[model samples]
Target: MDVDEERQRSLKRSLLCLCAAELVMMVNTTAFNVALPNIAESLGAGMAEQQWIVSSYNLVFAAVVLLAGFMGDRLGHLRTMIAGLGMFVVASAIGLAAGNVPVLLVSRSIMGAGAGVVIPMGQALLGILFRGPALSRAMTAWAIAGTLGVPFGPLVGGALTATLGWRGIFGFDGVVFLAVIAVIRMNVPRTGGSRKSRSLHVPWASVAMMFAGFTLFSAGLVNAQHGVLTAGAWMPMAVGAALITGFVLHDRASRNPLMELGLMRDPSFAACAPALMMLNFSMYGIIFIMPAYLETVLRHGALIGGMLLMPLVVASIAGARMNDRIVSRIGPRGTSLLALGCLAAGMLTIGAAMWWPDGMMRQSTVLVGQLMAGLGLGAGQPAMLTWAMGRVPIGQSGAGSSLLTVFRQFGSIIGVGIFGSIQSGLYTAEFHDLAQSAGLAPQSAGSVTLDFQRAADMTGMTGDLMRQAASRAYESAMTGSFAAAAAVIAATLGVVALISRRTPR
Candidate 1:
């Protein structure tokens, strides 16, 4: 083979390896949610601890991910990825050995740090690796890796938790990281920094503000379960908002901002922000709530819940593969509108499913909704990202990719938090009335309410009457949450409609 052919083969191998690592990163992120229940039981964790367990990683991930992309740009994508993999491996090992909630939370936060670095670097590197049609295909695979991770996470987590216990999930992650590291070392080519990269200074003030803002915002949102008026629910959010505002002002003034603030000037890039946010808001919102819904209302086991969720993952992968052709034929705007419509329809379907008393009907309807939502997100996200990137210069792909990733992650943070609050609020209100009508004493009612407070786990409700009430309350709460998601999708569709076709392709 000629030297050019040899180099092409190596690049393909490297892309595959990087994609594999990306897949594993997603698996680890999503699988942890499935394992949370098991971890709570094993470690005797409280409701607050469980919330932290899940949100810590996300909080940390969102805080540092932007910086990770800059590191990839300045240092090297491959080197950053390797560092992330090594950190992930160590973090997983720590999680496997964790004897308490704090240790596990620390481990998860560390893992998120690694994943934050890895995720943006992977996307940045992919931009560097391919061009034109090849870039489209590579991004399709990348999108598949991401969307596949969401549903597959529960599947893998359920299987691992059922068979080898929750620790097995962490152990599996460690193994995946190790294998990916080997592939990275063998296949990926080294990339040098740009000449102008050294002149670019890291905006430490903006970084701190961004990190503090997200962390506090997350803390506040997670605390919303306490009640919207409570200090836990609003104070941190207030502080976070202020910090984020400060960051925006600082970024506007900086000579070399962390991300290209000017990208929003392009209509296509501007649209991608909320468009991707809404996509993830719908997708992750459901993923956040479904495991509990499956186990509680439908009374499915973890493994079975995972199996039922498989159609979503499978459909997402199919949608991503089909998107390239669809966009080419229908144009980007048409494809986007259709995807948004599908998402709105899916949310409505799921909401309707919640009202059904019959198990078979509810499951089937939910399955259909899952498929629709997955396909919509799978198609819409890749198109939005591609469109946004087209507007970006090749030199700034890392920053561009980072901004996109942060938008998605930000959406996830808000989606999960908002949905959880909706469910918890609705469930609490409904359950109280149900419990009172059931003629339980105030003390008994309080205990039962506390048991179902998180709205994620129904294990504590023992008697048939309590279980029945819990299920009914859960179903109602989920319906309200789904309706909220549908509204978000509809609103996003309206925003997408405003983007003119005259924008650069």
Candidate 2:
């Protein structure tokens, strides 16, 4: 074979390794959802703690990723990736040994920082290796790898948690990343230490502003569980909004903005970006809500909960397979409307299922809804993604992509934070009333309300009352959360419908 052919084969191997690394990152993001209940049981975590343990990572990741591209450019993509992987390996070790909630949260945030660095650098490396047709194909592989983690994450997480316990999730990430790092050292061709680019500008102020804004914003929303009227809830929210506004103004005024804000001026992009955001919101919300419900409320084991999500998984893949053909028939606009409708319908159905008998009927309804929702998002999401990206000017595609990612990641944060706050509030109100009606003492009911596993383990009439109230409260809260997801999807549908006519075919 010619030298070029051998080079091509080696590049493909490198691509595989890089994509595998990314898949590990994505899986770690959602896999913890299945383990949240276990974590809570082990650590005595409340609603806020549970949400932050997950959101802390996302908040840092979303905030850091914008700046990570610059880091890659400065440090050299390969070198930056190695450093990030090393941090991830160390953070995962910390997570494995975490004895309490605060420590675990700190560990997750560090992991998020590593992921923020690794992902963009991984993409940068791909850009270096593949050009023209190969570049597009390589990116498509990268995108697919990221997508697969969402549906399969719970299953993988569930299996790990069941077999090796919750810490296994962290252990798995650490082990894989270490192996990937080793492979990169051995197989990936190294250029010299990467040099900083002369033309590139790093917006340190914008980075700090954006990061602070999101953190404050998400913190405020999560704090709303205490009551939106409280100082804790509204104060940070006000400041966060101010900071975010400042971020935008700063970006607009800056000569070298962190992102291409003008991409939204195109009607298609304006509509498509939020559609992607809402899609992210929907995905994050469901994964966050479901696992704890299945594991704690319904008394299903982690493995069973993971297995239960398979229909949604299978259907989503099928929907994705059909995305292109549907777009061919109805166009991207029509395709998105259909997908959002199905997504909303599924969420509503899940809400409705709680009213049914708590045995097979409830389970079947949720499963059916999962299939419907899964198919909708699966079929619809790629179309929206394609539509949004297609509208970007070739010259500005990188910045456009970054801005879209920021929107999508924030959407995930909003989903987790807002829904978490809402769920906490609903559960508290419902449990309070139920506890009062049962004549239970405030302290016992408070403990039960804080964590479902405690109620499951208690004894006697009080235990029975606690169990029932906890279960009922969780169900009620979940119902409300699903309803909110449906409402968001509905609003997104309205927005998209308004723009569909204006959207370029």
Candidate 3:
């Protein structure tokens, strides 16, 4: 074959391999949402532990992403991606077969590490394979694969859970992971980049700092539910603050820092990072909390909740396509501001709907609000990422993009942990107050609390009183959580406004 034909064939194969890898990684992050309740039941997890199921994955994933990018630069993207895929496959198998919660957590953490390796390197490889419009289109396709995977995950996951069980999702992932490896091996070219003499070290100190900071913050939020405060919680938070301070200084002074601190000093890059962070924070919060609301409040099954989320996914895809057109016209700054406004408005609308009396109408109103939020998220995310990278030099694009990805994932971890805590706290407090107002004895109230917790584990309540109490507690908790999430989104809007105003137009 001629050179042109060979090049076209090579590009097609590489893009397909990249798309498969992207899809698997995205699915790994999102498919578990549908299984969370089932997982909790099986493991007998409380609110905090359940939150860890998601946060643990995101925490390790985000923490390691920067280092993964550095590894790709030194060790070759193809090699890094293949190794990640292998780890992902092993982790998936472990998760699928594990009988205990700790094992599952370990499996998830390993999966996150694998994801860290695959995603950044995959993007870097795409950069190597294509250029100009072809490159842009390829990258856009990757983004679409990843974003749409969130919505699609529930559909696939829910169906699998309904048909087979929660474990099926992980088993499916394992199979898909192997498929990705095969695709990469068969199709992707083995290209080599420069091996700079950068640190092969994993920056354990910085990782520990982030881990401590997030853990303390998450513990504080979780403790808020029990109406309890202890030194353990606050101490971690203080240490976290200190560690973060030290981390910043370390990054600045290190020859090859985990992150390039100087890039953050750029006003445009700085502004975009927070906006992207807030957007993902809100996105994951809704994803994490909405299913519970549907299951407990609306009396829907996992499949139904997944279906209800479909519109948001569809709107997001439409919004992402529209973003490409508008970014050139309004520029990234204006487009982002507009998107943020839409997000804030959408969140406020949902919050207002939650204040309505519980009914079908209230549910409908909230779903509308979700669609609006999804639209804003879809438009804002692509523009923010593209704009953030665009402002930096081509050579630094990987680092810049990786930083944004890290912050976004960190936002996801924080969002889930905080919102889960808020929901748990609100539920516990209101349930106790309601019991008192109903003239229940103190001993009876304690029994009711035990019953409620047990009801979450088992399928049915043996007594009418227990069922009624559990239902009230669950609804109250979900409503309070949604309201708090709305406030968080509102705070995000204010933050975006301040940041965008100062961002160079």
What are the lDDT figures for the candidates, one per model?
0.78, 0.78, 0.71
Model 3 residue 286 CA deviation in Å: 1.3
The order of the candidates by lDDT, greatest first, is 1, 2, 3
Q: Give the poorly placed runs of model 3, Cα more than 4 Å off.
A: 1-13, 127-136, 190-192, 196-202, 227-229, 438-462, 500-505
Residue range 1-505, candidate 1, lDDT tens digits: 9999998898789878877887888788777777665675577664456666777777787777888777777777778779988999999899999998889989989987897788878877877887777777787888888888878898999899889999999899889899989988898887745746455477788889999998898888878876888998899999998998888888888886777778788888887787887876776677777777775456676777777788888888888989998999886677777788888888989999988878789878988998898889789867777777767776777778888878877887888788877776777788777766776431222212334443334344435556667778778888898998898889878987786456643
Give the candidate order by descending TM-score.
Answer: 1, 3, 2
Better of 1 and 2 by TM-score: 1
lDDT of 2 at 124: 59
Task: After superposing candidate 2 on the true structure, give the runs of residues whose Cα lies further than 4 Å from its correct spot.
Answer: 1-15, 72-83, 120-143, 182-201, 391-398, 442-451
Q: How well does candidate 3 match the true structure in TM-score terms?
A: 0.89
Clashing pairs in 2: none
Instruction: Count residue pairs with overlapping backbones in model 3.
Output: 1
- Expressed as tens digits, the lDDT of each residue in 6-96 for candidate 3 is 9999998898888878876766676688777767666666666777778778877776778777667666778878998898889988988
Q: What are the per-model C-alpha RMSD values against the true structure?
A: 3.0, 3.3, 3.3
* TM-score of predicted structure 1: 0.93
Deviation from native of the Cα of residue 264 in model 3, angstroms: 1.4
Best by TM-score: 1
lDDT tens per residue, model 2, 117-224: 777567656656665546645655665566667768888999999999999999998888899899887766653223443236688899899899989988898999
Clashes of each: 0, 0, 1
| Residue pairs in clash, model 1 | none
Off by over 4 Å in 1: 44-48, 195-197, 441-462, 499-501
